[model samples]
Target: MNHVISVINQKGGVGKTTSTINLGCAFANLGQKILIIDLDPQGNASTGVGIENNERENSIYKLLIERNNLQQYVKHTKIENLDIMCANVELSGFETEVAEDKNRAFILKGIMDELRQKNQYNQILIDCPPSLSLLTVMALVASNSVIVPLQTEFFALEGLTQLLKTINRIKMSLNKMLEVEGIVLTMFDKRNKLCAQVEQEARKFFGEQVYETLIPRNIRISEAPSHGLPVIVYDKYCAGSIAYEKLAAEIIEKQKKFNFAA
Candidate 1:
């Protein structure tokens, strides 16, 4: 069975792309076939995995908008059992293009159904844009679960309310089985008293919805994308790599519980 997850945050700079790449890589290393869909128009996920946007012809944009074939667009990453669907600047136009189609909410789900029928991937991860646009909505519709990443800042919980509301709306209207995977606290600095305060407040509000693994702020994480690699691949000993590996374990445990309960 495939677990399709969308890493989403309406507020950017919360390490969404970093989490996506690291989880994909870690899963692949564990011998699972993984596919990362770069839904963000910025294409950071593509570059983070060492794929150049200019070097590709059929990206996710063409596959979504023109209903083009996905066979050529899917490319293998450096890690074994991991593949990627790169995005380009052209994906920005999908907001207007899929506007009139009522079933636009299910476009991504339709594509995933086709891919699943082919038994291509065991897990599909979507890296979405940092906004409440149609792209994000489509990603939510396509995903069975969503992982929300939050920065431990003062305004961290502000956008979260709206994001949860949107998720609830999507569940009722489009995806009845959608579930929130968990809230991951990212970019945390243990030295900052304010960060600690923010963490306490978030825990008070969200309770068990937050993950046990909190990702610390590390310079290597920010530097990895420029080098076209995930932090785990770029520097396995870095704090970011260690944190993400812990997160991967936590995620796997939760999935096991879900499976057993079923």
Candidate 2:
């Protein structure tokens, strides 16, 4: 079965796009067919996977507005089993454009339901914008679960509370099956006492809902997006790359348990 998950965080600069792109690549490397939906107007996920701005003419914006023919919008990334539906600044206007439609929130969900019928991908990851806007609502309504990239910093948990509330609101009214897959602590610095403190607090509060993998504050991860590549592919041996690969394995194992339970 295909799993559709949104890599989401309301606060910006939390490694949300970085986690989405790297995790998609890691899943692909593990022989899973992955489709990354660049729902963020900034299009960082598209650029991270090597989809240039010029190539985003048929982007997620068009897909949401046109509302048909999903395959025509999907573009293959440099990775073998990874694909992406690019997005650009034009997507920022989507909220205003769809204001009159009461069913606007289900637009992406309809597209996702169609994709599931095709069964072309093992995993679909949506890179949500850094805000609790209409786009984020659409993604939350479409996804089966969410993977939150919680930055290890002051007020991290405070920001997470708002996001969790939003998810709960969506689950109650929009998507009944919506759940948090796991919380990934990003940009962790082991030597920093605050980072360790944040991790302990997160594990204590969320317990098993937080993953074991901690993505370190590595320069390699920050540099990979400029090179239009995932850190795992740019430098396979880097600390960031190893962490993402391990996270992917952990996610897969969790999925197996979920499937068995189902």
Per-structure clash totals for the candidates: 0, 0
Candidate 1 all-Cα RMSD = 1.5
Residue 133, model 2: Cα distance from true site in angstroms:
0.5
TM-score attained by model 2: 0.98
Over 1-262, each residue of candidate 1 has an lDDT whose tens digit, in order, gives 5688999998888889999999999888788899999999999999999998676568898888766576887999887898999988989888898789988888888887778777778789999999988899999998888999999999999989999999999999888888988899999999999999989988999997898899999999999999889999899999999999899888888888776111
Which parts of model 1 have CA positions greater than 4 angstroms off?
Answer: 260-262
Residues 1-262 of candidate 2: C-alpha lDDT, one tens digit per residue: 5689999999999999999999999999999899999999999999999999999999999999998988999999889999999999999999999999999999999999999999999899999999999999999999999999999998899989888999999999989999898999999999999999999999999999899999999999999999999999999999999999999999899878776111
Model 2: CA > 4 A from native: 260-262
Q: With candidate 1 superimposed using the best TM-score fit, by how many Å does residue 181's alpha carbon deviate from the native? A: 0.7
* TM of each candidate vs. truth: 0.96, 0.98
**C-alpha RMSD by candidate, in order:** 1.5, 1.2
